[model samples]
Every structure is written in structure tokens, then in C-alpha cells.
Target chain A: MISFQKFRIYINKCFIALICLFSFVVLLPFLMLIARLVKSGLKYICLDFFTQTSPSPVDAMLANLAGEAIPGGILNGICGSLYMLTIALVLTVPLGILTGIYLYENRGKKFANLIQYLNAVCYGMPSIIIGIVVYVSVVKSFHSYSVLAGGIALSISMLPKIIRTTRETLKLLPAYLKESGLALGGSYTGVILKIIMPAAKGGLLTGILISVSRALGETVPLIVTALGCSMINWNINAPASSMTLLIWDFFNTPNMVSMVWATSAFLFSIIICLNLIAKRIGRQWKFILYHE
Target chain B: MNKNHILELKSVSISYSPGSYALKNISVSIKPNAITSIIGASGSGKSALLRSINRMHELYPNIRMQGEILLGGKNIMEMNPVEVRRRIGLVFQQPNPFPTMNIYQNVLSGYKLNKIYLSKSEKDRIVEECLRNVSLWDEVKNGLNKNPLSLTVGQQQRLCIARTLALQPEFLLMDEPTSTVDMFCTNRIEELIYRLKNNHTILIVTHNLAQASRISDYALYLEKGELIEYDKSNIIFVAPNDKRTEKYITEQVE
Candidate 1:
């Protein structure tokens, strides 16, 4: 009976090892794809890759046929992404933070619970579904897919993340801080804005950074709203391009494979850089404000 | 409504629910320029009674308080809570100086919160005076920019006192201010409270009978939400009063 128990333990160990191996195997292809993309993507990157607009698909195809490389860069896509993200952040951050504070302050109230439930549902909703909704509401109403519509879509997706993070961060602060503030003759709004919010600044900033990174990489929403342009377009009411959209547009074509890889590498680097910078600043901010 | 009384509580009771009372029908008058200590065992409503002075009990949604608390002959319930708190400050059991603020900022936090603007020199003077009153000025004067958390527990408690004093409050309510600190720190804080009573009416809630004997001019002994004795501190300590107060002081029924 003891020997049988030993065999059962040994079998369990083997199953665990097999599961680990299976997970690694599933992850291996993604690792290799990233490696290959980095290698080919670095070869195509140049100063003009950020400074010049992407060529038309036909122009790019003709250039490839003539034994020339793709003639233009992804400046329009980069600019468009930045524009939409800025608009989205402007639209979403204040509203999200205020809602978060409201939820925290009015925690046990029915209205707060309702807002929390709605936020959870919004957070769990698929990116494509948000895209389709935005397409119908904004794109159709405007009679054209525009960057403004794209921004509205990204803002909706980013709001729940910012709101949740802000609420959680504020809640994690000790109750004594608020009590002390109130005891010092501060109005409720004054205490929240001055003491509680300042204490949670690092967490709020980190949340915004994560939200921005997520918005930057989103493609599905833009596809239905902005509808991808090759030329640089600054008008919010006109079609625009973003890095993700460019990658999506190029990846399926036979000759634009290198462009897709290059764009992917660029986008990945930006997102990683943003996250790292945010973490570093957050640490520094806490050290400056709260270090003992 | 005696002129000497800085604060008066008349038949005040606090209940968190319909049927249970945390503090039951307690009435007391606090004299100005003196330290009055509320002494009781744990769960005896000392803290609840102290909180009612500044209306701190109102912050909790579940708490229900009845009757009147008057500050200087005016009913505090009719006044704005924020304004009432400005005149009657509170110090909690724990030494909670704002972790995000430096010592200088923490001291001036009251003024900043109340929007009582001062020129830079006036601000410096208030900080110095308040810190000196707490006897923490010499230790912390050089490190005004340091985080409040960098200070020892004793210094942190003193810093909180200074923060309260910076607002020029008429009455200071302390709920077990020395309960979390060392014996030495407690002695220092007790001394500061003794000195502060010359300018401010101070109400302290303490579990330590010895501390109440050491610092308080008047003693208010409570038992099971009832005011069992209110007398001069020396009398309350040395003489017999209510059997419960005597029993608690003797540690026979603690």
C-alpha cells in the first residue's frame, strides 16, 4: 500500500512537469515570432521611418516590383495614434477619477454599487464590441469614420481601468488620514483633493499610464471608427491611421510583411518604454512624498 | 452655562443602533485652561464621550447621538462641523502625522486646510510657536523638511499636538494620545498636556489611571457607558466615590 502511494505521488509530479512543458511549448512560438520581428524590424527602421508618411498600398507594391524597398514610413500612423490617445485621455481621466472618488466616498450606497456593477460589465465587454458600438454611434452619426470617433471608443475602454485603479488605491489608504483632515477643519472636497488624492498620486499616475498603453495598442476599435488612412491627416473629423492599424493593414499583403513587422516592433517598444517610465516615476514620486 | 466652563455636555448619549447605547446619558462641564481626563476601562464609552465634544461621532453613518454639546455656551450641533472642528481639535490614539507631508507641512496643514493664508514669515512663526509648545522644536527644528514618519513615536505624537495647536483651537480633545508610545514618550506628552492647559481646555481619554492622576486637574470616571464620578483629580484618586470608580481605580474589578 505504501509503494502504491509513492507511485501515485510520482505520477502527480510527472503530470505537473508535463503541464509545465505544455505551457512552455505554447509560449515558444510567440517568443520566436518576437525574436524574428525584432531582427527584420530593426533592419528596416530609419530616421525617415518616423518622419515620413506611409506610401499607398499600390505605390508600395510597385516599389517592391521595381526592386526597391517600401518608399515611405509610418509618421501618419504615429501622429494619428498620439492624437487619438491624447484626446481619449483628456476625455476619460477626470471623469473616471471623479467617479472613482464618488464610489469610494459613498461606498455602501446603492448608487455606488450600481456604478461599480456597471463598470465591471464595461471592463469585461470585448474590444471589438466597443468598436462596433462606437462605429454605430459616432461613425454613423458623423457620416464618416473619423479620429474623433476612434478617440471616443478608446476612452470608453480606458475609463473602467482608471476608475477601478483610482478607487482601489484610495481605499487602500488608512482611514486616519481622512479623519485627521476632517479634524483639521477641512471640507469633504478639500480633504479629498488635498490629502487623499495627493497621497494616492503615484497609483493614479501608474493607472493612467497602463490605460494609455492599452489604448495605444488597440486596433479593432480604430478599424471601425478611424478606418485607416495612408497619408498624414491632422483633422479629427477625417480618416486617420495608427501603428496598430498600419500593422493590421499591411500584415495580410504579400509584399508589405516587412512593414508590418517594423510597425509591430515600434509599437511594442513604445508600450514597454511607457510602462517602464511610469514605474520609475511612480517609485520616485513615492520616495519623494512618502519615504521615511 | 457657567462662564468658567469651556465645554458642556448635557444628557448626551450615543448609539450605533436602535437598542444599544455606546454612551448613555452623560453630562459634564469642562473648565477652561485645565486638563480634564476621562478614565474608564475598555468598552466603557470614554472614547465615545470624548468624541462627542468635537462631534467626531457624526462621521460614522451608523452612530446616532442625542442631546446637546455646547462649546462656550453655543450649541456645537447648530454650528458647521468643519468650523466646530477648527475651534475644537482632536488627537487620536495613534501618532498619525501625514506620511506624505514633511514636518513643516504637517504643522501648517491646519492653516492650509482652513484656507487661513499667512505670509511666509507669519507661517514660520506659527510653526515655531506650536512646535515649541509641544517641546519638539529643539529636536525637529533642524529637520523641518524631513518626513514626519522619520520621527520617533514620541516626536510624532508631539508633532500631531503641534499640528492641532497651529490652528489655535480653544479646546483640544485627545483620545488615548499616549497609548501607543513608550513610557518616556508618554511622560513627555503628559508634561506637554500639563503646560498646554494654561492656554487651552484639554480633554483626554485614558485607560491609564496613573496617567490621569499625573496630569489631569479634573477626573471623570465612567463605567459601562455611565458617568460614575466627576471630581477634582486628587479627590477622585484618593477618596471613595462610586463603588465602580473605586473598584476600577483599585484595579479590583478591571
Candidate 2:
């Protein structure tokens, strides 16, 4: 009995210590990276860092930019990112939600299975490959690089992820939620739009935010299709640049390297803001889960 | 053949697939203004029978049902499934008040979905009366804008009942509606079932024999998907004609 107890204790210790060791090992790199990045990345961050663009190779200390800082702000890059995320979100959210609904509502159909297979394939397809497809289809058709082109490409990558996440979330919802909606005389469209949408709002928003952030960082697809531009441009019909391309651009220009750090800082701030907004929305959506 | 029969099932049988029948050949009548209870063990097709009244079986493409279920003398299977569903409201065992909507919006969900336009004040009156009928008005009156999820489990179940009541259905089908709820909510639902008997026909599927006895005028005892005995609640409870019913009651008592 004593040996049995010792054996059991040994097993318990092995399991608990194994988990702790694995987690610590996994966290080590992240801890080192954040520490290094913050220590090095903080020096290049300041008011001018955000305000000024690189007018010259030598004047990239951010003071020059702060000196010129005005309404322009990160205005152009901000506009580009917003336009990209908005277009991607607008197009992808509806299509993603509908695709999810189709997958669940008609899971038995051959067409549904085919679509699901396509969705899975697209999900695993590298972002660069998607960009290649979109480049040939959208940008090549238009014969120019535009925010619209980048959005179209990014949406391809975003669509499958958003759809899969949303469908999985909706699947987690109690089956009775949909049945209750139907029982209350809701139509097919009504059950999805009013009932499922509300119940899955938090998860849906999380999916969108994750997709948006993922799309925001997407460099390879944007590089081939939309490339990058310097000036502030709005009309999606016009050529534009985004933060990811900007990051890639600065990294190659060793003299313009500090601008990359500043940009990283800026991207981090926006993502933090996005996560905060998502959390607030998540709190709002806890209502649906509570009643479930 | 009764003209007043709100819903009738004639030799209705529902099958899971070709060879497997969930509900065997059964025929029953539901009155327009009375409480009818279906009491059976789990998987006895009691819920299946209730679902068939509204043709909700169509939601499951694999399941096939035979025979005819007439809703107000009209064959529901022949009618538009959507239309049939609208007129026959149902509540399930779980409290499923729409999580996205507030109490008022939950109540108005039926009308909103069907695109039945109602004025603001008129909507208020309907909401008030429905909540009051379910004994949830005073508790929720002040928090009309509060999300339905904020309510306790009992309140949420009551909210679902209110959502069903708002449709003004001719018949309401509740499938084990109280099985998942606490006794306080169960009592409230039972009382609502009794009260609703004066306005609309109600069908309930329950495992609680005492509950079925208290609120139901008639009881149908089903076993292994077969309707074995259906009679006045007192007769079914006290002097069950079928051996299965007797066995079930005795087992519950023990």
C-alpha cells in the first residue's frame, strides 16, 4: 500500500510538474522577446515618432516628424488600415455568417460539404497564395493596385477564419436557442439575424477582431497585390499603403529602422484598443450565454 | 369528427428512418380550450408527437411522419410549414428567451419576425398583458430594457412563455417545459397552463405524473413510442387500464 501510494504520488508529481515545465518553456521565448522588444523598441517611440514621416534618412529620430505633426497624424496609414479592415469586415462578416449558417442549416447537402471542404482548404492556404489568387483575379482585372485590391485579397484570407470561428461559436450555443426562436414564430432569416446573431455576438465580434488584426498584419498578400504607397489616399479606388507594408518598407531601409519600431508601437496600441473594445462587447454579450 | 377539436392526429406515426419508428400509429384529439398532457418515459416519442402538431418535424430532414394531423380541420402537412408553425406556438424544457433581446424585444420577437406591424403603445399593452398572465409582469415591469439573460432561470422560462404568448397562438405545445426548471418556476408554468386553458388549447409532455394529474384534464400514457392508454387524468392516475402505466406509476412511487 505504501509503495502504491508512492507510485501514485510519483505519477501525480510527474503530471503536474510536466504541465508546469511545458508552460514555462513555452513562455520563455515570449518573455525574452517582449523584454528585448520593449527595451530596444521604447527608445525610438515618442510624439514625433507618430507625427512625422521619414523626410530624410538622417532625420528619422522622430523629432522632425513631431515638429511637422499636425492634422495629417498617422492619418493616411490609419485611413488605409481602417479602410482595409472596414471593407474586409463588411464583406467578410456577412459572407462568413451566411456561410456558417449554410454549413449548419444544410450540413447534409453535397454542396454544403463541398463548400466546407473549400473553406478548409482556403483556411490552410498560405496568405501569400490567397494574395496570388486575388492578384490574378481582382488587381489584374482592374490593372492597378488599390486599397480595394488589398481588401479583396485580405478578405480571402479573413473569410475562412471568420466563418469557421463563427460557425464553431454558433454551434456551441444551445440547440434550444434556435428552436425557441422558431417556436416563437421566427422565420429562417429572423432566427439567424435576431436570435443567433445576438446569442453569438461576443464570439462573432471576437472572430471579426481577430480576423481584422490578422488582416492588418498581412504583408505578403498586400505586397504582391496592393504593394505600398507613401502618401495619404482614401478612395479605395485609388492606390494606397497600409501599416504592414509600411513595416516591411522600414525594415529594408536600415537607416529608416526606428520608424519601424514606432510603427510597431503604433500597431500594438491599435490592437490593444481593438481587444479592449472586444472585451466590452464581450461583456455585453454575456447576457445571451447567461440565459442559456 | 368533432368540430371543436383544435388539433387532431389520425393514425399518426413518426419514424426515425425507414424501419425505425419513434412514434407508432396513434390517433388523438386536442380540445380548443383545455389542457392535454402526454406523460411518458424518455424517448417515448411524446415530444415527437407534440412537435408534429406544428409540423416542426420538417426541421429534421431525416425523420418521416405518416398519416394526417389536422389543425383546425385543415391538414397541417398540406399547409405551408411556416404558416402552421406560426399558428402553433411551442416552449421547450430549457428557458430559451432570446439572449440578444431585452425583455420587451423578446416578447415582441414573434411579431417582429412575421413583420406584423404594431404601434408602440399597442405593443406595450400586449407585452404587459402577456407578462402579467405569466405572473412575471411586476418583477420585470421596471426593467423592460434589461436583457432577458439578466433574469433568473425561472424568469427566463417565463420570458419564453411570454414570447410564445405574444404570438397569440390558437394552441401552445410545451415539451417537458418544466423538467429543467426549479419547482418555483414549475409551479408558475403549471399555473400558466391552467390559466391558458380558458383562452387556448395547451399540450404538455411531462415526466411528473403529479403535475400531469393536477393540471391536465386528459392524459396520454405512451411507452416505447406506443400510445398505450389515454384517459381522464384521474382515471389514468388512479385506475390505469394499461399495465405499463401502472408499472411506471409504481416505479415512480417507489
Q: What are the TM-scores, per candidate, against the unseen true structure?
A: 0.94, 0.88
Tell me how each candidate scores on DockQ against the true complex: 0.63, 0.62
- Candidate 1, CAPRI quality class derived from DockQ: medium
RMSD of 2: 3.6
TM-score of chain A of 1: 0.89
Best model number under lDDT:
1
Question: Lowest-scoring 10 consecutive residues by lDDT in candidate 2 chain A?
Answer: A67-76
Model 2, span B17-85: residue lDDT tens: 898999999998776688889988889999899998887787888899999998878898888766777
TM (chain A), candidate 2: 0.86
The Cα local distance difference test for each model comes to 0.89, 0.81
> Predicted candidate 2: interface RMSD?
1.8
Off by over 4 Å in 2: A1-22, A51-75, A235-238, B1-5, B240-254
lDDT of 2 by residue, A1-292 (tens): 9999999999999999999999999999988866666765676666655554433334443544566321222445656777887888888888998898788777769999999899999898988888888889888888888888888888888999988987788777878877777776678788788778777879888778877777878889988777777667777767777887877877875456556666777787677787788777766666457643
Measured by TM-score, the strongest candidate is 1
